[model samples]
Target: MARRGKKKGRPVSGWVVLDKPVGMGSTEAVAKVKWLFNAEKAGHAGTLDPLASGMLPIALGEATKTVPYVQDGAKIYRFTVAWGEERSTDDLEGQATKNSDKRPARAEVEALLPAYTGVIMQTPPQFSAIKIAGERAYDLARGGAVVDIPAREVEIGRLEIVEHSPERTLFEIECGKGTYVRSLARDMGRDLGCFGHVADLRRMEVDPFTADDFVTIAELETARFGEAGRGKPSSDGQAPQEEIRLPDRFEDIDALLVDTVVALDCLPQVSVSDDTASRIRLGNSVVIRGRDAPVEAEEACATARGRLVAIGAIEQGMFKPKRVFGG
Candidate 1:
């Protein structure tokens, strides 16, 4: 008699929405999630500063193929502004550079909010990762070199007050990607006739990934490594989770993360006929007859076969490989 091996599980694929906790860098969190799944490919949709907390979308396996679609989405955040002070880093973590003897009036700050809204020019801080002359601007700044950062255009879709104290003010923000919340706080302080710096910060949304759909870091630990509620543990001893759903409360740290399976929305998808599916299993793009690509597609997605815009299908007996979706 011969012994038989157990059946292997379906290949794991999808997205992970981590409610990134404060005090950790985005890169570090992605590393832990990657190691847990041991997936061959993974990537994050947005970049969050280590000093901030909020929603982060981590794509796994085939989901990595769809990263571009997600990365280009709009973003939102909530943060604090300390009145009568300014910092070098634009946030509470930076060294104090200036202060005011008196707090700016609340009405004055409210009036300034209108000017900050809509499209406006902004300068990236020198103590940032922006590259210049083949070196990081932050590196140059750290090396005691002064560099001029020019102002460019950015849109502040919405800026509103959340709360205000004699010493600190909080705000909720919605803006396009690449907009810096810290810079906004700093600018607001200046526009309001007082010194100001970000005292705290947290992301609320990343286009498709909303804070409502986020799960705190501590919650991920429970779902991935705990008991029956741990979903499905990976073969590598890391627990796997089922589909993640949006939480009722934006502040829940232990809510379940959205599903880990990657899905392609807003793109043309064609189900291959029985015979054609088998022919392309050898790993090639398939070409078919009588198929009409979607009319309302993106400008890039409208290219003819082999332009990198088209995927799937094979010509003749061979599959044409254009863009490989899986990492």
Candidate 2:
């Protein structure tokens, strides 16, 4: 048998809530963060378009297993709609497909908010990643094929105007997963008799994560170099002698990581003893003790001494381990 080479990168694990910059796709962002941390594995909780900027929670190593929780969570976005022209892609990146001279008034725009809230059927933008018979919709759209994508149900928790003018309208919305801000602008424009498209968009929150958890790429770069890269100004106002120092150790930058269990904030959690945790790690079902413990849970996590032990289900007072974690 041939000897397999050891996997590259360290087994560093945790979440890196990135304040993703515009013009960088989600895949690229994940790759960059993975390289920066030299993690064994990496993934992102949700996809953020290259044109949009804001909170992008990235998972490394064992944290990747918890991505589904974050992806399924509610999202809040602030976007601007530029009136007059509707683009093929429904954003600034595409060519104009429809034009309108009429612009909606502030009151008229506000009036439309009530109709958009709650559960609504929305057709996703043509230039989206949605699959059509194993082919990506964006690929088909790029090839000049206009697909008749069906409208699907999406929940909008809140929709309110942040600012409004005759030429443009800014709105903030809290919506469920699979909701597209571009589609929202396009549909609203059609209803108001003034064709419009997304001019700028920024995601402000994603479930457990908010702007408070954001760490920018620039900040990451600075953290990588450490204080050795900083130079103190000379008192004489001239120049200070250069002091060269070796770069900080790898562990220095790991401080920015949010605990892997943070992603499970929305799920039910159970605390287990060390012996029980060991059993869970071996893929065994253990009886959950305590009167306050949940009788059953479709999705839950078990922790041992504050560390994640497993993610699985609780049924009939028993916790069955599905995905176990390492120390």
Candidate 3:
């Protein structure tokens, strides 16, 4: 059998907490980050809609293996709901489908919060990625076909109003995975007897990540192009006045990247010896030492020499490697 060819690009691994601007799709952002780093692999923790802006944690290289952990983490969103009309897609991008003259007052919305605070069933918007018979629901909706989408259980940890007016209301919500802010606005509008839709949406947090770690596209572009110039003016007046050239190496772009182990900070960490790390690298289980070490855990990660070795569960004082880190 012919050997598989080596993949092109560097084996760079880490998380890029992107402050995604509105109008850029999640896939496009991931591709751009991957290209900027020249990484062999890249993926995102969660999908951010083109109409939304905020933290989109992108995984590069070996970091892709830990994508699910970040995806399952709680997320926080700050959004504004425009009253008096409910749109077809539940956001500003869609056409208004339902209209109402009645506007919900501040007190009316506050009273309805308790009903939506806990675990509640939510029906995703028509223009959602939910599959219906192997086809995307959004595709069907775009084709002018209205399909019955079932409601799924989602957890809303906290929901509070930040600002309110007769026209639009701003809100900050902390929710679990699979919770949709668009659906929340739609449901609240329906319950308050005034049709509504999301006017603006911004994700503030994704568990381990917050706005503090976000790197804007402009920052990445600057880092990519900024250092290429020699920072010295040319002797002659012509030829662009200064020397400028392309980056000679990937490190030329000094974009901040969170360590791969940091993404698993929520889980218990077990520091292992070099011998144990060797077993882990071979996808084997090794007995965990130290009296302070956990005897058993549902999820845990083992690190050796200040680097992540593997992520797995602790069973009867043994660390079994489920996912080993190549980085």
Tell me the tens digit of each residue's lDDT in model 3 across 93-203. 999899999988899999999999989999999999999999999999999999899999999999999999999999999999999889988999998889899999999
Ranked by lDDT, top first? 2, 3, 1
Q: Comparing candidate 1 with candidate 2, which one achieves the higher TM-score?
A: 2
Candidate achieving the largest lDDT = 2
lDDT of 2: 0.88
lDDT of 1 by residue, 1-327 (tens): 988875333244567787877877778777766654444566898878888888888876656766777777777888988888888888877788888876866777788888888998888876787788889888998888887887878888899888888688888888876687777878877776687888889888777766567665555545544533334333333344665332232222223434332233334444445445444444544554444533232222212321122243343433354444322
The runs of at least 3 residues in candidate 1 whose Cα sits more than 4 Å from the true structure, single-residue gaps closed, are: 1-11, 227-293, 299-327
Report the lDDT of model 2 for residue 248: 40
Q: Which sections of candidate 3 miss by over 4 Å?
A: 227-246, 252-255
Number of clashing residue pairs, candidate 1: 19
TM-score of 2: 0.92
Local accuracy of candidate 2 as per-residue lDDT tens digits, 24-50: 889888887776676789999879999
Worst ten-residue run, lDDT, model 2?
231-240
Put the candidates in TM-score order, highest first. 3, 2, 1
Candidate 1: lDDT over CA atoms? 0.65
Which portions of model 2 miss their true places by more than 4 Å? 227-248
